[model samples]
Target: MNIADVDTPAVLIDLDRVEANLKRTQDYADAHGVRLRPHIKTHKLPRFAKRQIELGAIGITVQKLGEAEVMADAGIADIFLPYNILGASKLARLQALNERVTIRVTADSAETVAGLSEAFAGAEKPLEVLVECDTGMGRCGVQSPQAAVELAKVIAGSPGLSFAGLMTYPAAGKYAEAARWLAEGKRLLEEAGLPAKIISNGGTPDLWHAHEAEVATEHRPGTYIYMDRYQVEKGVATLDDCALTVIATVVSRPTETRAVIDAGSKALTSDTLGLTGFGHVLGYPGAVITSLSEEHGTIDLSASDKKPKIGEKLRIVPNHCCVVSNLFDVVNLTQGEAVVETVPVAARGRVD
Candidate 1:
């Protein structure tokens, strides 16, 4: 399909850039001797996950049980979930999923561990559980090393759970401190005779410094596959590195300095990620995406030396590419200007 033939407010994934992003990150993991178990929350495509494994990923990581089921159906054998899963409904599904693939999960509390233990108690194999540690991100992890080891002991002694290791998603730019915290947790685990098997640390904001977290045996980076404006602002990716972009048509030129595009918050997303604008206008370096409603994105073309006229198309690099993937059902894969293939987002709403 030609680029012009495709409808406006569509997502475009550059095939060339995708390959470069995959190989570059994989090579870094290889050189650093750390396993690259990429998180699939970014692309959520089975094909891309398979490509990641082909490039040398240890396995794939999913943030939700529903996502794991989708990938498992696609023949992805191993998956690591880095969220604290609970509730009987989700646990029942987790049991069914565990029967089909190798799975590891993280827990920050005893209640979560109990649920996992009960779900896999009579299974043929024990479920491996990692104690989620909050080195500094302050999201969903145990606060201190002592707390981590205590949870590890609880998991190890559980009916159907084995303490695998420690996992954390630290605050960006504070990996060194997070490492120190994780290292202490590792030391305590060792002293307690429970050797950690996987020290997992991840975040795309500090992709290049992933190796510096020496305690982490595996890294889970999701956004590197389709770099976004947030990654660019953080200096983790350049605009050229961005593989995903929103193609929107200029609908109305309300004024000489203002224009409206078909893509809006539903396409470009409202996640500013601390940036000034919603997204970066690809060609109009000076253009600012001032505001976005559900179906309209207001563009301030005054700053731009050149502006698009009515009926012209604009490409926007969203603030967060992962969220954008969930909004679109299909993403057009293109090489240059020709749309080579378009695929459904297999796990689009598998956010259970």
Candidate 2:
């Protein structure tokens, strides 16, 4: 089918742009001599994850056990669960997943590590554990480098747990600071006779700056595969680098300057991050999405000489592509203007 034949508010991925983004990121990591474990949370499709691995990614990073399970079932051998795995039910799932593949999980608490060790004791394989450090995000991680080292030591001494590395998701422009923090933690761990080989840090905004940090052995960048408005707003990627967009039809021209499309928060998500609006209109670079409802995207194009009329189609790049990917069940893989194939968002909404 042609591009115009597709339904409205459909997810479209430009394959040429995606290949370029993957090669660029993988080449950057190769030149820097660091492992690239591109996070699969951004594009939860197994085909994309396998493509990333084929393009020199050491493995894939997942945010939850459910996502990891999906990837593992799809034959992805090396997987990293960056979130702290808790609860008996989740631990049992993790244990089973560990038996299937090389699974690594993150934990910053002694209690979590102890619990995992007990749950996975003699489970046919040792679970690699990384101490999640709070470099500055103020999220779920240890407060300081020394604190991270303490947690690492606990996991190292545990029966079924092996200290794999130190992991953190620092805010943008905080790479230098996070690098120092991880270096300090590695020093302390070494001084205490504990393992601290891998220092994994991830965030789309800091992917380019990953090599600047001397201690980061592996970088996990998910959105680099499909750049979006959030990455563009943060100066991480350019508009041409963005691979995904929602194709919508201009259903109404309410005013000369404002037009409404059939794409809304349900299609593009309501994630702005204090930015302009839902997304940016392609070709009409000056046009901005001012407002959105469940099925309407209000675009402000008062100054444009080429205003879109009713029934016209417009491609909108979402503010956050990851969330947009989760909202859709399938994405039309396109090359230039031709619709190639529709790939299912296999792991969409697998957030458990």
lDDT of each: 0.92, 0.88
After superposing candidate 1 on the true structure, give the runs of residues whose Cα lies further than 4 Å from its correct spot.
none
**Candidate 2, residues 1-352: lDDT per residue as tens digits?**
7788889989999889999999998888889886889888888999999999999998999988889989998999999888878888998899889988988989989888989999977776888999999888888899998898788878888998789989999865677888889889988888888857778887778888878877888888999999998888888899989999899999999888999999999999899977877898988877879899999989999756789889999988898899998999898999877899998888898878
What's model 1's lDDT at 228? 96
Q: After superposition, how far is residue 167 of candidate 1 from its true place, in Å?
A: 0.5
Q: Worst ten-residue run, lDDT, model 2? A: 195-204
Off by over 4 Å in 2: none
Please provide TM-scores, in order, for all candidate models, with all chains considered together.
0.99, 0.97
lDDT for model 2, please.
0.88
- Give residue 163's error in model 1 in angstroms: 0.6
What is residue 343's positional error in candidate 1, in angstroms?
0.8
Superposed Cα deviation of residue 139, candidate 2 (Å): 0.7
Give, for candidate 1, the lowest lDDT window spanning 10 residues. 91-100
What is candidate 1's CA lDDT for residue 252?
A: 99
